[model samples]
Target: MPLAVYILGLGIFTQGTSEFMLSGLLPNIAHDLGVSIPDAGLLISAFAIGMVFGAPLLAVATLSWPRRTALVTLQAVFIAAHVAGALAPGYGLLFATRVISALAYAGFWGVAVATAVALVPANAKGKAVAIVASGLTLATIVGVPAGTVLSQFAGWRAAFWAVAALTLLSLICSVLAISAGHGATEEPRTIRAELRAMARPQLWLSYALTAFTFGAVIVTFSYMASLLTDVTNLSEGWVPGLLALFGVGGLLGMSIGGKAAETYPIRTLVLGTGVLVAASVLLAVLAENTAVTIVLVFVLGFAGYITNPILQARVFGIAPGAPTLVGATNTSAFNVGNTLAPALGGIAISAGFGYASIAWVGAALGTVALFGALWAGHLQYRTLRTSSVVAKGTAQEEDRATTHA
Candidate 1:
């Protein structure tokens, strides 16, 4: 809601664009680098690996640094990494730089949650965080497709250069928007404390929900090019358009998700995940019709994304003290899902299942996630209700003591 959030959103947008642009340009990169498409795809895998390792590590490592400095410094590193990638002479060098750039990726995500919590009031907290995180959805729609297009015209290297410039701009925004006192206090979450939070049943359940919900989506979506050409009969040129369409739905879903957070939390997750599962099934079955396929893809993107903010907010509420750790872990959790989905989806396809079968896998995952949300809702209700009663009892005792005196 604040100006600062918009600035933070810009950083997220740039990060999302820079991170995913390669998916659209995979074929081009393979050709240019004189490697196989699978080898070129390693750049994406390397980044995910970085996040899995980097997200929580950055959360823990930046415990002492001020939040503002940490964010600025991370963006700076991101800029450098992009530039390095843009100028990289070989695939090995570029892949290594991608890993190095990912160091800041986790740090930014870790700090971004902490920053949002500090920026907003208790009720608007979810929405605030959503605003920052929604940048990912936008990248799906605008940034990635735009980057992909830039790749088509200029070259894959040029896309990285564009991302480098975007990161540079994000650096300026981070420097200007965040308050000086933002990161003044050290993070209080000790490793043990963070582990204790993780040990909670609700926490692991949330992670499970995150992994499968996203994994099913990614596995199918990763091979989306095949689906469009094989099933929908789209030209290679149209893949970017379809991706852009999905991105649009994702962005709209996030904006609406922020609003939805105010009235209901867990209920929103139920609705969003349900839509995603149903839509995935429909898309898989009816993809033969081009117009229907387009609509289904849009809805799939919208429904799948709306749950993202809700889940992150759920994690933060579950572990209020360890925002950085929980937040970073969830980010990694989604990527873990992303990493697993492709291989799993490929196996299903290799086993003679059609593209639509991936949707069944996704549907099963969503069903499991729905149950997870129900469980989380129960934990959340009990925890809050118990705390409320204790506070009321404490207040009554204090009142009686003061009156007697």
Candidate 2:
């Protein structure tokens, strides 16, 4: 709603472009870097690895820093990493840059969500965070496909350079939009408090929900180019357009998700996970038809992301005592899924399951997440009913005491 929230989204857009651009550029990167396509996909996992480990560590490391300063500094590091990526001389160098860039990107995500939440009222946090997440959706819509086209024409290195420039601009926006005193928490939390918050079982359930939901999506998406070309028989030129279509669906999903997360968080997860499972199954069965494949890809994207805001908000809800750390840990859970999905997809591909098998992998993961979501919903309902009973009992006792007095 605020200008600052949109600016935070801008920062995520730049970082997200770098994160997902590789999906479209995998073949180009593989050829240029003299590695196998599967190996190039490893770059995606590498970036996720950096995010998985870097988020909480960086959140703790910057606990005392001004939030705005930390946000800008992370973007600066992101810009430098992209610059290095643009100039990388070999696969090793490029891979190193991917990890480094991801570390900064992960740190940015931790601080950015915390900042966005901090800037808003309790009722508005889901929307604020969703606004920030819209950047990633927008990246998929514009940035990723654009980067894919640039990589196709000018080479993958050029795409890296473009990302660097965008991030620089995002950094400037962050500096201008975020208020001067916006970074530090109103009541600074202790390290022990943050740690204890992480130990909650409900928080871990949220983590599992995050991991499985994202893993289901990534497994199918990581090898989408191969599915498009080798299976659907599409031309190289069509890849970016189809990817952009997927992004459009993601944008639609996110807009709906933000509002739904605030009003009906559990139902949102249930509906989203159900859609993902069904879509993945349809994609697997209908991969042979080009028209069907295209439609299902859009459905998959929409369903895959419909729970994004809810999952993020759910983690924060369960761990209110450690909002920043919980948010960062949730980011880690996302990347954990990102890291695992590609690896699993690669294994399926290596085993000669063909590109279509990726959809099955997604379906399986989505099913697991669906069960988790149902379990979580059950826990919430039980907790609410229990609390209601206790409150009613207390009220009756208070009334009796007042009458006697």
Cα lDDT, all candidates: 0.80, 0.88
- Highest TM-score, which number? 2
Q: Which digits, one per residue and each the tens of the lDDT, describe model 2 over residues 31-51? A: 877899979988887888999
Clashing pairs in 2: 67-183
TM-score for each of the candidates: 0.91, 0.95
Which portions of model 2 show Cα errors greater than 4 Å? 26-39, 181-185
Where does model 1 exceed 4 Å of error?
181-198, 381-405
lDDT for 374 in candidate 1 is 78
Model 2 residue 319 CA deviation in Å: 0.8
